[model samples]
Target: LSDPFVIIELLPRHIFSSCVEQQTVVHKRTLNPVFDECFEYSVTLEQCRAEGAMILFTVMDHDVLTFNDFAGEAYLSLNQIPGVDRGTSNADNFHGLKEIELNLMHQRDREHPILKTLESRLGDKAAQDFMKKCRERVTNF
Candidate 1:
């Protein structure tokens, strides 16, 4: 049994400084956890239209005595979201809610181009630190 939680990150394609992050409450002692939650980001429609803007969902197993373990991750592009591509649309104007189901990948793609680019940012302390934390979360068990 594992205590699982989810971290949601909104990231711009080329700018890491503007990243917005949120997390779900940990669901204790269950491999199958239901995180019925909603997160709203203070992002503009322009930001949503920006190329490569995406939301990353990372699931982690909570641990009291040691580092949390990575369970899985999913990525969704802002462009693909409903009401995002529509003109002059507000949440209230969007009558129905669109539910998105994503398949989680159990393993991290170490050789991904984005990961490589982030890894190459040796001069950027923030990027380096972010990558370091991500690397540390690689499943060892």
Candidate 2:
């Protein structure tokens, strides 16, 4: 088993590709990790809903010498998240939803750069199938 952490990438409208990024502390040697981390990005409501806005959650293994391993990832639309799509007010902020659980998954395409790398290291069939099941099971409300 390997230590794992989470990386959050936020791309707002007209912003550079690598604008805002955050990461959670590494959790050692566990498949299920619990993280109590917070991230804040200053973006207006209009920017949040813009077509260029994208939120990516990437799960990676913490490696010391070699490159980190990609476990899974999920693409989140800020518009789909509850309370985020609401009007510009305190109510829209993620206040009561302190323990929001988002399930991240591997990308579906075998040709995807991350997934390709993951498959090459972990073998193709089993890992890809597992990821497909995870994606189907996750329900965003």
Candidate 3:
């Protein structure tokens, strides 16, 4: 870690690791509330190693004793693939920005109450493609 303070500046959401001291070069990525909170993370460790981040620690998902506590062993698996932050969009509009939001939400909640309506409303396929990619990325991790 550059500085304990600098690590805070990183605001690591999709990740947490003891390897911060090993000089982690975090990838730029967005955050989503639902997936970020739900699953134990499996960010790619190989990418960070390729990017010059050496592992000093790790935390495995299954070893994560509680909802939050994970084995430090898995912390070495810190690299993340790009654009995998949120799996599927759950927004609500996309003929425009409004519709785009709806498109994302609909994908996120293909079965949500309000989102059923939003899915019915969107016309573009692009957002769905992106969301599909998101789902695949999430599955891979």
Candidate 4:
């Protein structure tokens, strides 16, 4: 039995300053949890077209006494999302219903260049602390 939840992040390529994050409510003791949630980010269409811009979904198991455990993760490119490149003139089209099923993966690039760059920033205590928390969330000990 596990308490599962999901963290969703909107990351723009090379623009770490504008990352947006959101999360879903934890569903108790269920392996299959349906998260009917929506998140909105204030970003321009150009930002969505930026190379490597993506949406990252990380699922974790909640623990009352200890830190949450990483379950899996999925990544979706911004360009792949519906209505991003098509313009948002029609609010209806922009907000049109589109469903996606992502195949979660257990392993992630721990030594990713971005992660290394973020870790190397010793001056920003907040970034350092955020990175530490991210690492802890993904680490299962």
Candidate 5:
């Protein structure tokens, strides 16, 4: 197994853009990694609803000489968060920890430019195979 890390981005969709972007520390050489990590983003509920924000989770393999490998990707919406409700779009409704499950596979419905770039860098076949392993290996977190 390779050392792995997670890159998380909270990007606002459409007119609204750029907000929270962060990454977790790399776990060294483990098939099963437990990351009891926490991250806070200062995004208002109003902004989230108006922009239709998406949380992008990119799992990558850490490498020294060569470029890191793209393991898998999962996407989440701010609206899907426990406290946030789309119907109300109330700022007061935002609070607390929500357990979000990432898809861990290529989402054909929407285009992911980052994934395409990573695949191009790693070669299409290599990226596809690695991502497949990531999907099989990682079910939930």
Candidate 6:
């Protein structure tokens, strides 16, 4: 298992195909590419203090030739979807919501054995009421 502090790529969107028009950079840092050339990567942030916490970030990719540099970057102008994750907010963010939760839910998915057992033990009426309360809680979030 990877250490918590050992930051690493969580997705394959780290690398992309762009037309290299400039110099002869020769180091392959691409995720799956075996090319003879790879760009020299570096980070040059001076200061990033958040609530007295010193932060350090890195330059994941930089394409000087394209106008879409912010394509893979974070954008904060989107609205949050409700009843999806108990919702995510900017203050604490949706940091607790996992990938699967954020990607929408499967309506017709089979129930787990635990869920079946609980439904049997709790009775359908009680389970329905509990689920209704859950949905209400999510909606009110």
State the lDDT of candidate 2 residue by residue for 41-102, as single tens digits.
Answer: 77666677677566878888988997677788877777766645665445445666544466
> Least lDDT summed over 10 consecutive residues: which range in candidate 3?
1-10
* Per-residue accuracy of model 3 over 1-141 as CA lDDT, tens digit each: 111110111113223343223222222232321221112233353334344332223221221243322212222222332222133532232223221111121123335554344435457464454345334423321
Candidate 3 vs 4: which has more lDDT: 4
In model 6, pairs of residues that clash are 27-38
Per-residue lDDT tens digits for candidate 5, residues 7-126, read 887754332345546899999989778777888777666766655567878888888997677787887876776546656444454365455656687444223575555546655665
Task: Report the C-alpha lDDT of model 4 over 12-80, residue by residue, as the tens digit.
Answer: 435545665789999998988899887888777778878877888989998999878988888998777
What is the descending lDDT order? 1, 4, 2, 5, 3, 6
Off by over 4 Å in 2: 12-18, 86-93, 98-101, 112-141
Give candidate 1's TM-score: 0.76
| TM-score of every candidate | 0.76, 0.63, 0.17, 0.72, 0.62, 0.18
Supply the TM-score for candidate 5. 0.62
lDDT of 4 at 22: 83
Clashing pairs in 2: none
Candidate 6 local Cα displacement, residue 98, angstroms: 16
Q: Residue 119 in candidate 5 has what lDDT? A: 48
Ranking 1 against 6 by lDDT, winner: 1
Q: Considering every candidate listed, which one attains the maximal TM-score?
A: 1
lDDT of each residue in 57-133, candidate 1, tens digit only? 99999999988889888899887776686665555554586778999886556777887898899999768876886
Candidate 6: which stretches are off by over 4 Å? 1-101, 123-128, 131-141
Shift in Å, residue 33, candidate 1: 1.4
Error of 1 at 41 (Å): 1.5
Best by lDDT: 1
Q: In model 5, which range of ten residues has the least summed lDDT?
A: 132-141
Distance from true location, Cα of 123 in model 2, Å: 33
- Poorest lDDT segment (10 consecutive residues) of candidate 2: 132-141
